[model samples]
Target: MTTTTPTPPAPTPPAPAPPRRGRALDSASSFLRRRPRLRLGLLLSAPMLWLGLAYLGALAALFATAFWHTDSFTGQVVREWTLENFRTLFTDEVYRTITLRTIGIAALVTLIDAVLAFPMAFVMAKFCSPRAQRILVIAVMTPLWASYLVKAYSWRVMLSGNGVIDWLLAPFGLDSPGYGLLATVLTLSYLWLPYMILPIYAGLERLPASLLDAAGDLGARPWRAFRSVVLPLTFPAIVAGSIFTFSLSLGDYISVRIVGGANQMLGNVVYDNIGAANNLPFAATVATVPVVIMLGYLAAVRRTGALDNL
Candidate 1:
């Protein structure tokens, strides 16, 4: 009887349900997964389009405007191509002097920033604990959070007679270097020092401590080791920082206006033409000077692989 009861077979289980087709989004994601290059291209397309339309388009318009001079009688832009602006920029002694002065200031600022930044960056990267390094980084960047005008005006006050600098130097019988070229340089150096410091800090952080120790073991003095090893390694980072400091100084007008007394840079010339003189063509022409100089500087830097560091 038991065997007969067992003879009744168990009911078959219900068949498992088939998976439904994926949604449109899932399908697209699967497709993209198979074509990584296409996915990357899609991601970059929007930014590239915006850059082309906004930045490159504006630069093109500026370059075009530079060729067209203003009608003196009408004070209106005349849409005609001419090189009179270039001719004047080259031939006029005032413009030439301004150009040279601008270059010299930019160069001096770069040199000063390099000299000051290297040691601070080395200390930050090699000596400090990680927490201290972060605190120092925040300290360096804190000034950038303040308004540009605020910083400039603060410097203006400090550079004024009997200001903080004068007070500090009073015991030494020294006066504040009043507003002028020196003030301009000092202000610009302060403004751009962070830009210089961060890059060199990054470079130094990437440097290996063993190299210094190895050099020491090889009977190299600190100065010799630094000149032969550290300097060469960090040179590209310095150049990368120089790009920021140099270009910013070259095109700076606000800082100059605040602290640069009667002295003028190429930026001042450009600002004067557009605002006071109402000469857009000449202003655009003046704008090209920095652009061209940067292009040349970049070309040279490209050779040294400094651009890669940036």
Candidate 2:
């Protein structure tokens, strides 16, 4: 009887409840996994929207503003569309000279940077050990971390009479090429050198050492190998670097103001129109010059397949 009274059967345990968030997450992950294109689109949507709104929107606004004009007496922007700004930009002698000067300086900066950066980048990519390469890269990038104004002002100081450049050249019959077009060119070259180096360095890094070796084995001299094998491959990268240097120089006004002395560039014109002259439409029109130049430059380089590297 006592045995029959049998201990009450243990109550069956209740089944555990499934976690809601975990199920949702797992389902989402599976859904995303099944549609990789959707996943990718989702990932890029935010950035693309930002770029479209911020960059392209601003550019559109600028172009729109360029067509309008300002009232000279009232000093208020007139929303009416007209080609007067374009006419002024195209017809004015001062604007033409400034445009030419801007283009010339940008070209010179691009050239100088290419010449200087190539050898340095070549040495870094082909010759240096990994640790040394890292150190050299740091050295190259250190200047970039400094304030742009600081670097510009530093050059200003060095280019001043009795400053570093003058001091260095005093022993010789030469003198510092003081603040002007020459100074502008030098400062721009220095400032944009890193932009050129980084691209060439990245390009050269991808170049096969085997190709260089093969050229040498086939009786190509060092210079010949470089010209035939290296230069052609690296040319796209040089063009890419030139784009950065050229566009940046084209739009730069601050460095010119700091070290350009009496000289002015297109950027100065835009700056003066916007600030001193209070002419927004004219400034937008002036700003379009560089944008047009860059577009043409990009179109020219597109044939070279340089855009692929970017």
Candidate 3:
């Protein structure tokens, strides 16, 4: 009877179920269960999309302008795509000289800002009380709310040959009037100084007092402690501040034009192309340089996380 029943085949274990045709749905559900990337993507989609479009539009407009040439007869930007204006800029020695002068002057202003801002920031961070720190921060940043154009014009009133310094020095033999690169650089440096100081102060504020204490414990002099510990820690903010000063100087059409005499930067060249020269394409092309440089700098600053302190 056992043989006849074939020993009643041991109960077959049920075969495992195969993955279904709706595999994506199962996968998606599984992803949702594990990762929040989908939620992040949904949240960020709008702003990312908008920013991409805006940058694309700006570049497109600039490139389009670059290709259009200025008509010699009418001084108007004609639709004809050409490189004559850029070529002319390269060939003209006078424009080249002005360009170099602009770069040199801007660099000088940035250097001056760096030299003066570091110690001031270090002092504020390590020494000043929290209340004093708050006041210092306000004092540094308050200048920014003032109109930039007004500030630049204020230099005109001060740096003119008969301005404040000259008036003071008039008591001595120095009666010469001075309104040129020297005056321009000085004014620009003072105007942009606060922008550098605030970032640096903020960086200093974040430094751990423990590090300075360690430096002191190790027999390092106060200056050595600052140089090795404090300065090194705050380097990112210096870079950040320098980047700001550089970019601001780069686009400083208003200040230079107001005070720079015959010295014209790339900004002036671009402005002239659009307004005085009436060549949109050349203006667009010239303007593209600063925008690109600014974007690259902004990206660099973001990577450093220095602006986070601000």
Candidate 4:
């Protein structure tokens, strides 16, 4: 009894008071909770600023430059707004030929990639185990680690006369196209195939196994199940991949220079006008062709649900 009286209940432990900083934090959180729209606006402000200032601003400047004329005698930007650039772009035979060539190659590359990627993506998504799928993905992305120029230069060497293509195909009496439009298509298809494969693979991966089972249970054959269920779901992914491949191929000038031989695409024309001819206005005008084409392509694809899928 004497010992119990001496303890004095340890001074009641100060009632375990809450931290002041924690109270401030709680008040801040409550403030944000009370103003949800303000919170969302604050969150979005940075990215909106970036998009408006950097991306849209650059595009506006580029299109503005397209309207300005270059002084031929002075070799300077005139800053005079005129439609003469568009007139020349549309009226010139060389520009038309190059535009068509660029479009053709881009289309061919996209088609080739789609054909090659489908079976591979289907096998990876539908057939492979999880670990194997991961390994395959790493393998697919591995080549992208190499410098684009390095790969282009490697292809340049391989496609040269008496290079690897020649050495390998000598026994079969076949030959590589050897530095031309065909060579450009081949290199581009190889480079961009992984881009196509990944999207379609993701789309296929998202397909439900139960859906396939249900289709089979309903008396649908493999082909029928694929046609009725799988293809429709995955078509968006194909279009998504095509958008990337097609747009990238449209503006590419380096690969064209390396493997395109004497052939010039729209990109080469733009590059020449800018660097060789010192014509920024005309270059901007030429540049608008691909931009317009891509815009038109996007408009066409918007109805396919692909944009929403992506």
Alpha-carbon runs more than 4 Å astray in model 2: 1-18, 21-41
lDDT of 4 by residue, 187-258 (tens): 989888888998899999999889999999999999999899998989989998999889989999999899
Worst 10 residues of 1 by lDDT: 14-23
Q: Write one digit per residue (lDDT tens) for candidate 1, span 186-267.
A: 9999999999998899898988999999999999999999999999999999999999999999999999899999889999
Compared with the true structure, the alpha-carbon lDDT of candidate 3 equals 0.78
What is the Å distance of residue 155 in model 3 from its true position? 1.2
**Candidate 4 Cα outliers beyond 4 Å, as residue runs:** 1-33, 214-225
TM-scores for all candidates? 0.89, 0.88, 0.78, 0.86
Clash pairs, candidate 4, are none
Provide the clashing-pair count of each candidate structure: 0, 0, 1, 0
* Better-scoring candidate (TM-score), 1 or 2: 1
Q: Give model 2 RMSD, 1 decimal.
A: 10.8
**Pairs of colliding residues, candidate 3:** 65-281
lDDT of 1 at 130: 95
Which of the two, 2 or 3, has more lDDT? 2
